[model samples]
Target: MKNVEIYIKSTCSFCVKAKNLLKQNNIKFKEIFVENSTANLSKMIKRSKKTTVPQIFINKVHIGGYEDLIIFLKKNI
Candidate 1:
């Protein structure tokens, strides 16, 4: 498996769902929490060009948010 990274905000339901999905698929991911730090959130926006939690990446390539992750999983997982 490729390196999976997920940027998540605390208390975000979509983030939980996304992590759950990954776990169900037995995918190990690095969880980046951006709920308390501005720098992390800013980095997420800079990388994804979107101000949203649960921003996912695979091997340094942007895989987008929750629904996008689902699609990617369906096609490639």
Candidate 2:
């Protein structure tokens, strides 16, 4: 498995769902809460160019949000 990171806001249902999916699949991930930190949010935006809640990355490549992650899992997992 590749190194995975997910940029998320705490209150976002999509973020929760995404994390849950990763957990269910036994995929370890590093999660950063964008709501609690400005620097991380800034980095997320710089990297993804989006203000969405759950910006996911796999192996340093942006994989988009929850739905995209699901699709990626279907193909990779």
Candidate 3:
């Protein structure tokens, strides 16, 4: 199993979808909510080099957002 980390916002539909996909695959993840804090948002930006909700990392590798995650799953699963 890989160590999965997801940066998400509470009300984002894509974030919900991403989490659901992971759940369906039985993949556990650490979720960092960046909806309210600038510090966390900045951290997510720095870590992912992206300004999007649902930035995902698996085993410290940046895997991008929901669409990218779906692509990764299709190729790797």
Q: Local distance difference test, per candidate?
A: 0.93, 0.94, 0.94
lDDT of candidate model 3 versus the reference: 0.94
lDDT by residue for model 3 (1-77), tens: 49999999999999999999999999999999998989999999999999989999999999999999999998989
Off by over 4 Å in 1: none
Candidate 1 lDDT over 1-77, as tens digits, reads 57999999879999999999999999999999998989999999999998988999999999999999899999996
Of 2 and 3, the candidate ahead on TM-score is 2
Each candidate: RMSD: 0.7, 0.7, 0.9
* Model 2, span 1-77: residue lDDT tens: 67999998889999999999999999999999899899999999999999997999999999999999999999997
Candidate 2 lDDT? 0.94
Q: What is the lDDT of residue 31 in candidate 2?
A: 93
Off by over 4 Å in 2: none
Tell me the TM-score of each prediction against the true structure.
0.95, 0.95, 0.94
Worst 10 residues of 1 by lDDT: 1-10
